[model samples]
Target: MREGFITYKGRNIVFTDYHTHTNNSFDSKAIMMETCQKALENGVEQICFTEHFTLNPNIPTYGHMKWEKYREDIQTCQEAFKNQPLHILKGIELCEPHKYTEEYKQLFQKEHIDFILGSVHNIKDIGLRKTLAKYSRLEAYDLYFKEMLLLVEKADIDCLAHFDLIKRYSKEAFSQDDFEKFEPLIKKILSKAIERGIGIEINTSTVEALQEPMPSHYILTLYRELGGRILTIGSDSHYSEHIGRGIKEAYALAKECGFTEVSIFENRCATFVSI
Candidate 1:
């Protein structure tokens, strides 16, 4: 199980896991309200239910959710937890924005989504998990970083989820040399993310599950060097036990990266909370 903590800012901020999946996502097994209820019990002030939104033509689960049903589930959770201290926000973890822009836009237009996390789970017909398993470690790292740049260049979403998630499965392939090789692409993505007013997520779930942080120190340093300021911290928890995991470490890393403010999104606009 993963541990949780209060943020460094001392806002009584509680913990907010912005990236989470429920049964709405094909790969997740937890139900929507059950996850939100767990957040409440864990003292998480806010939780964003960002179920997966895949667009790969080869995947049977692509476009698995109906917006109407998703909206209904969110509404049910809201009403059920209204008097509770926890605030649940509707969100989606978009996989490969270049392939599903229209579908994403339509969902955003119709739903009162508080946040949207852009993720590159699929690249050139390769899913992150599959890519790591099928290719050499260095090869997969290169592909992941390259596609991450592509995602940033093409998507205009709130924040980038698990910026170094490919490493979760390819840790054995990572090294100072690999980081150096991908530094340019990392910097490029951060620069573009800044230009587009998008925030990057300090995904703590990676640390909890993979034993290594996302946007590892090297990438975080590169982001700071490129004047990337906006950042959001998320646990990316799929189950109750993982809620609020590693959030304090995420905040500490952000501060170490010279970020004075952490970002939160509402109505698709970012609000910064000073650390």
Candidate 2:
């Protein structure tokens, strides 16, 4: 698969990870500068620190982010690496933007974030971590996909992060048959993303830990078959050591699935880089 990488004037294509977390996020412990150095060493030309900033009232991490300090830290890294080849970008991974419309609108009004990743972390107000045991298997899958469709249609984001993340925590093991049942909703979500100019993130954090990335290989292929062109690869790393894990494989998989380019964002606009 690595042999299929398209070159630009004899230069190998480098990658940009638009989704990552830092110590500013309640769940991560990665120091900003250390992560930058690690990413640069791993051949990531551009890296965006998308710290978790959620508005969900039910979650403990809500309102816990220190936005000013987070932005300051990113600026420090950007300046520190100014002369280097690695480009540091500031971003936020907003959980469930469709559920927090007012907060989403108000934050974007003042925050000068370079990238915004819209993700659905819960189903019907119950977080995914605790949701599996509360509902029937069928009900859980239904609610999850339904919310994803709504997010794709209503959330104003540059890309959808971890489109099918519930599988990572579900009580039932996911199977190809299960994904086949979800094909219709999946297609709708992909179609809406394409129409809205939003890209899909291939979250590689799951690959090292869970044996596959979020949304599975079948879903990635289906996205390409459905004419969805925009894609991004993210390690979703909470630690510096995991900075570039599984990203090369994610890019190769995208190339195999017929995606010639991966999307990167700046000030909410997408720029495509060939894989």
Candidate 3:
């Protein structure tokens, strides 16, 4: 890591972890300002706080976010780091955006946002971790993909975060290498993403436990082969100490997946930056 810029094919790879949550989110206990400070110290230049935004009242994320506070917190971090190279992006991780059209539209009218991350953390009002356990690996993954496909097709989002998160609770019922059965659905999702100009987020939090990103390396390659251009990486950290845990490896993996540039967002528009 030369000057903290890892060399890959004569280029320095600088990373931005775009998937993060803090005290503003229901499941997180991290203070936003502290998380930003720690993440920057850990070699991450850009930290996007994509706090979970869910409409399902049964889930923890529902009715939990204090929009004004979350916004003010990011603004404060920006002012504090104004002279530094640190960049803070305000984003929301929308759970099932497809199902809340009116509410989703209203978010834009009332709040200023930089990015929207779509995700499927549950099925039939139940968290995937609990819902997935009730079925065989294939059956469980199939259900997850179906919901994910629906999200891709109908949701108002920039990209899908933690695309293959179903494996987090698989309990060894399926191996990461055995995703051949889900190729068709994966391809469809990738195609739709490319068509919609929505990028794919390679969530690296799993690398600490599963030794790879959420969607796996194979899915990443497939995404590149399908002419997908936009890509984003995240650590999915909820605590300050976990801020940059698997960030470097994620960029290395993206390079291996043939992406020389990655996408960053502001005001709902994307800008590409070199790896």
Candidate 4:
């Protein structure tokens, strides 16, 4: 066994970096093979390339992904790593799936992916960063979770990505977490996620840049208290060097939050493995 590697009967992925992107994503240019090689170098056993995918005609991500090309690269990566420890999963990180239910419906009618991470990259059609300029940091965060609650309530998503993603765009104004201040709303959001059988991701993408938890310690504790067991850890890497970054730290944090296993998905079904 690989040192520090968690195994699931030597057949299932152990949940390494599930939120990942590559050239297929609108905002990233990392090559697929490079990401795989980098994950292998970092001792990552598996990675799901959840490239940014959206159908908003008003956004840059609309029609940006060449699905055919992306599938080819995944095939190539799987073949190249067929003899190695790395297992690449096909996934898509969707923006506001609840807002584009019909589009998502059409998508699922033809395509089936292993995972989908639902995120609110924008609020009311405005970018999170732009919202900070129009509202107080606290206001922006409240709006963020409120919009996120919509997805948790309606989207056919496996998990919610970055519960406090607004913090990523509002750090300039406030470097602290405000989970307590928004506890009621957050409780509704988390409870809805559990009720809908949706999971959440501990996005470690900001561990180096922001030095903060994605959901804060409070959010993790709340999920546990609510009996939420389905969670995954991801680096949310957009570049090669970002692959597998902060994964060990996220695993430790999960353990501290009273979680023994992290989840992985295949054909959209979750399988938990010891972290």
Number of the predicted model whose TM-score against the real structure is largest: 4
Candidate 4, pairs of clashing residues: none
- The residue-level lDDT of candidate 2 at 88 comes to 81
What tens-digit string does per-residue lDDT give for candidate 3 at 13-115? 3778889989998889998888988977898888788999887787767898888898799999999987766788899999878788688888777888878
lDDT of 1 by residue, 23-106 (tens): 788887788877887777676787888888765667645867777888899999989988777777887887888666677667
- Output the better candidate (1/2) by lDDT: 2
Candidate 2, residue 194: lDDT? 80
What TM-score goes with each of the models?
0.88, 0.92, 0.92, 0.93
Candidate order, lDDT descending: 4, 3, 2, 1
Candidate number achieving the greatest lDDT relative to the actual structure:
4
Model 3: weakest 10-residue lDDT segment is 1-10
Q: Which regions of candidate 4 deviate over 4 angstroms? A: 1-15, 171-177
The lDDT of model 3 is 0.82
Over the stretch 34-67, how does candidate 4's per-residue lDDT look in tens digits?
Answer: 9999999998998999999888776667888989
Tell me how candidate 2 scores on lDDT.
0.81
Q: Which window of ten consecutive residues has the lowest lDDT sum in model 1?
A: 1-10
lDDT of 1: 0.75
